[model samples]
Target: MIDKAKLSALAHAVIDTEIEAVKALHERINDDFMQACEFMLHCQGRVVVIGMGKSGHIGSKLAATLASTGTPAFFVHPGEASHGDLGMITDKDVVLALSNSGETSEILTILPLIKRLGIPFIAMTGRPESTLATCATAHIDVSVANEACPLGLAPTSSTTAALVMGDALAVALLETRGFTVEDFARSHPGGLLGRRLLLRVSDIMHTGDAIPTIDEEALISQALIEMSNKGLGMTAVVDDQYHILGVFTDGDLRRVLSQEINIHTEKLSAFMTRECKTGRADMLAAEALELMQRYKINALLIENEHQQLCGAINMHDLLRAGVV
Candidate 1:
């Protein structure tokens, strides 16, 4: 039977070793690392990453990170490169090749061709003086003292070291290019961050005849009827020209009841809350959420540059739009 406790202990040991490996990576970021960043930044074309096996897997992830963070990059398999994918690499582009031992056969097989093309190449390797490092325009040392594997053969600590080094390279280049979160969002427009940054109020607002509204001179009973009909829990009190004068909410109705005001005989303008929060139709939906949070309000009226009631958005609408 398997010794579950021993297996758990071994797994913990491996995690500790990998953690130490990443911790030791700070010392390796020297002049060569800076040179790698500088070379990539100056390249006029995209970053083409190539590797084999486990290194290729890591390279794919690094390529994705680079592309999402503002660097145009993609991964090409080393074996595929030999079979005509090398055409994807251009003299203007930079090639980032990963090989822990610096002698991955599949990667090294095409070195002569890269040299012939005169494309700038960077190598990540455990050995400083390996063939791959020697051929690179800039070499990043991802040397691990030992493997986390008990047999010292599996790619463990070494792979972690290489991955962290790749992240360092991407982030260094990201700062050099001044990559912003908005730029990052453009690359990941399908996630929550994309929705928060890209979604605007006009895209998800109740406008036109659907907006629940009543004139300031309207009776409270009529405003309540409008709120009930629209199901927005509130109604905007506007003037004849549709300028928002105030807002009446279910909470206001409760407060009026507590004050013993005759709900059937009151005007909405007399009891409505003045200085209601408003947003622009073109503003980001995320900004509307922030305004709602800051003012502790549940609903907001949308206005134009002239402060006319163009539309309205409530917390539920924001929730439906993924703004929450």
Candidate 2:
């Protein structure tokens, strides 16, 4: 086996080099960077990203980030652009090309066509005077002094710099366009972030007949039956017109049993926890989860503007909705 100390040292050195590469990017965020953002910002169509080799991989991710944040974008392989995908680009679109060496033949092959179309071209390359940079409308330098790879052959530090630059562009455009969390959630409706930001208490809560509820005058045994039937492990002790008064849970049942209280006849009000927490229907399920965690409660009743119980939710509901 290789020496453990040598391996550890190598890992730390790689991390240090990558960190420095990212740090060097701060100074390069200058006029050219803003010019690139302006071109993308003013474009009426999508931002078309093209690259070759390892730069191609980073370009794909950059396009994804730009699309998800606010700017419309997609990655077109330079090789494919030559075959037929050049049609994917339009006169209204802006092109962002990536080339660490600024000399990829495939990307260079399409540079003339892009120039002929008269669409704005932005280049992210290591060399300032390279043909690709000199041909572009704006050139954002992503040069790193060293690669994180000790061999200096792999695209580690350079790729990191490109990724960071892409994120910088995405975020700058996102803020300038007034993109909100709701807008972001619309783009990622299937992810956990979407659920946390968009899922509301009303969307998942049990409403109407599904709510486990009992009267304030109900016996302890009646609350247990309601909890069992609804399968929420708790019952809201509500009054006429469905206004919540208290809550009876399995924990209250344990107390009743330990005290040798008569479940068959004892009023649940005497044992139920009064002033139980409630949630608003419009509140985010994530917020409700926060309320539950803060108050150390498992189940919450949803109340409407009238302050009457309308629906019920539990930890299980949040978990099932992927908001836990």
Residues 106-160 of candidate 1 have per-residue lDDT tens digits of 9889999988888888998989899999989889989888799999999999989
lDDT value, residue 158 of candidate 2? 96
RMSD of each: 2.5, 2.7
lDDT of 1 at 117: 80
My TM-score estimates for the predictions, one after another, are 0.89, 0.87
Residue-by-residue lDDT tens digits, candidate 2, 1-324 = 789999999999999999999999999999999999999999999999999989999999999999999999999999999999999999999999999999899999989998999999999999998999899899999999999899999999999999999899999999999999899998999899999999999899999999998998888888899999999989998888888888898888898899998899998889999978899999999999999999998988999999899999999999999998
Q: Candidate 1: which stretches are off by over 4 Å?
A: 1-9, 256-266
lDDT per model, in order? 0.90, 0.93
Each prediction's number of clashing residue pairs: 0, 0
- The candidate maximizing lDDT is 2
